[model samples]
Target: MSLFGDDELPPVTARESQLDFWNQVAFERVQAQFKSGSMHHALLLLGPGGIGRETFAQELAQWVLCQNHSQLDSACGSCKSCQLFVAETHPDYHLLAVEDEKTQISVNQVRVLIESMQESAHQSGWKLANISDVAALNQNSYNALLKTLEEPQPQTLLILQAEQLQQVPATIRSRSQLVALSVNEQATIEAWLAERKGGMTEELKLALSLFPQAPYKAEDFANNGDAVKCGDFILDISCLMQGNESPLALAEKWLPDIEDCCLWMLLMMRDLLLLQQANDKSCISLQGQTEALTNIVNILNNQRLMQLNEKIVELRSLLIKKSPVNLSSSWQALLIYCSQLAQKTAKSA
Candidate 1:
């Protein structure tokens, strides 16, 4: 699963940088809890994907485990605990998540973490376990976790991060305090990107438009050529709308990365919806494709656009859930729907 891929965990330094702008508020909340000595044993950090929820959780875990964290709630970099954390070998810290290519975190994984909680803290400080994707916890895993959450471990902090709170079991959510994170202002994000990368490119701008809530991901997409692929996908779909491309051919071409293609199509459908409603264009994801989107809006009415939007959303949801799907068939079906909508529009015209 892409959500739990074998990507290396960002080092403490990288995580610190990732949390630069969005951390202060969430950090302050955790700090206050720490100061009052009433910190919740389990904290659920809720936010959109790519908005650094996991990084925030890691930062909070470090703050709790740091032996010499000052009153300002900052981790003292020179402390032994801080060093161990930076080295990603903090004996008192544990990270639990679905392994690479796994659809869910297994019961065995949860049991191991739970058993680890039974041991004493290695450094006589807080023992922190950060669960990166709480939503990916299977039923058995969740039950195992629920048991631990119900029976609190003193000085043990469990940080749960998920994009959607509704996916988490109600019993577990009720036990854990919730902290929501969101994107910073556009200007703030752009300024940060400029400072970090020396300048912003068109790819970065489109990435920001696509993932406004996640500056880090936007930057990554821009740097790693994913942003360019997204652009090409948009252009290809625009060609499809013009009847110049075969949906089956396009679907076959994008079979390897159909999830991303679906995501791009969803965003394009969103832009078309906005344009049909005469909403502000600033909210559109495909910044330079306004002419193509406007042409699409001209071809489709609001109702048709809405129907297409629903179809695209359903497809995206299925892809995200890792459901068994025939990608080519699905894409062809969507294209057929679009073709039918266009025909209906022409008849009405």
Candidate 2:
């Protein structure tokens, strides 16, 4: 869903940068709790990725650390603390995430962060740590953080964020206050995109259609010409089905975008599988290629299609976990399976 507001929003401000429209309710509740001096030391802001949970955390942190709540719980943006936060030089604030090219947080990182939060704040106010994608914490990382979680420092703030909340252990969940965020409306998100991307174009529609309820992702898709690439992808799948495309070359060409390649393949196979069972477009994500996919679905070996779908799921999971597996050969084999999907039926005939 869209995070930024349209015409209804006031002029730009430091607070505006962090306060996404969909996050207002959660923000207000936290703000009220803070004002009442009953806010918890540790908080788990739970929501799907691209739904503005990160921004919500930032806004909350800025509010808590702001020496002057010059605008009703929003940061003043002029005080020393606000200035330091904006500069990313605040001695009292820390932002933690999975290190670059690495998928999970390390025990050492967790230990260091906990130690920093345990110290006296240089500003003598609040010491804060915002852990993005906290689900990336491994068992050892979690163990390192448990002591601090149980005995949270006074006037300290620890904000944990995760898209897949199930990945978080129940022990951690029980310690922190959880806030689950939801979007305003799909139409509102679309309107915000239209205003920013210059009217509701076909690319915009296709992007949003591809990534439902993930407006930022949709915007990224539109910006990156994935829409055209998707059309190309559909054509390549049809060509492969017709024995006009080589699986080896296709895999090589798609290796750079293997994750999306696998994802699109899965979604397309899903559409094919659905059409095999019933002629339904409502559940189709790649709506633009419905007719093409429907035509392609008619000749393939249905059982092989199901197996290919399953294989894609398995590979996709490996990619999501950043597993150290040989996917190059897997990709080639998967595409070979797809390329020959229609062959079995033809031979049987």
Candidate 3:
């Protein structure tokens, strides 16, 4: 499960292949800064989730603490500091993240981390702390961290990762230097995925499109049999709209992946809306299922699609917020609405 206990978001990959391939450019930029003595104390890595920012941060930490080589721009795994880091017992490196069964990092966690950071590193003099999701820090937690952000601890590096910058404060943003990471080379990612055994080229490419800028996530989707699951879901949605599948059964069947189901519904509705609005297939996201999506476009009007979209959005918000909700029943109503809308349109035709 992902940090949020949802499979919709992919966990950060520790694969050396991905950490090196996807983030080499970003890594080199920071390395250059380090070599030139211009590296900032606080580095904020901004990117979409699953693009290897956290892995880059971890590897960079090891590289910084490695005693054997500073010229290689990477950790020499045989070095003492590198060994300690690999074992996750390095005294200088700290990882701050949301606690289990909790949504956000607490102020107390921040205080404890900050207190430890004040002390000299027991092994390497360099102090490194990585906040996995800086956006998950609440206002109080941010306030608790402000002193550390404003002050300077010699050789201290704070690696902060955030998917949403709007949730971060202006003060924090000003104090940290932002590093952006993105990938537009679809062919390169596809080529990489093709090299993996048990991965079909066609399905891999389809997953690639679904997770834009997140190639590793696409690979995870394929490896976890999510592509097949998603295919079944698409078929189920088509069957529902065509008045074949019952909404209750489909909803119950998909209850375990409720959040993902909501997301897929939203994306499907988004595709349908775009198809109706622009009359262009390129405007839709589910490119592999153009025929089914086109038929969906005909099954519902813009107003109905928008209505269904609003409900999906609301339910997804509730799920992400961890609010109490009757997901199975709610999803059944959503599917039933789609079927009723299709039946009404068919009768009119």
Off by over 4 Å in 3: 1-18, 100-103, 166-171, 198-200, 239-255, 270-291, 302-349
Q: Stretches of candidate 2 above 4 Å error? A: 1-17, 69-71, 100-104, 169-171, 273-291, 301-307
Clashes by residue pair, model 2: 1-213
lDDT of 3 at 123: 71
Q: State TM-scores per candidate.
A: 0.84, 0.82, 0.78
- lDDT agreement with native, every candidate: 0.78, 0.81, 0.79
Candidate 3 per-residue C-alpha lDDT over 1-349 given as tens digits, one digit per residue, 9 for 90 to 100: 6686545532222223226486888888998998888999999888767787788888888878876435465676765677798999988899999999998899999999999899988875788999998878888999998899999798899998886565467889999999887886777777777787455565676577677677778778767887677767877888888888898888889989887677677767777888999999986667677888887787888887887788788787766544557766777787788788889889988
Candidate 2 C-alpha lDDT tens digits along 5-38 = 3334332244545677867888899888888889
| Model 2 vs. true fold: TM | 0.82
- Clashes (backbone N, CA, C under 3 Å), per candidate, total 0, 1, 0
Across 1-349, the per-residue lDDT of candidate 1 in tens digits comes to 3676536432333223345566578778788887888888988988877787877887777777776554435665556677898899988899997888987889999998889888988884688899988878887888889988999878888889887766677998899998888865789989888778889888888788778887888888888989778778777776776677877787778778877777778778878888767667787878877877877877888887788889988887776555568867887788777777776887778
Query: Top model by TM-score, which number?
Result: 1
RMSD of each: 7.7, 7.2, 9.2
Model 3 TM-score? 0.78
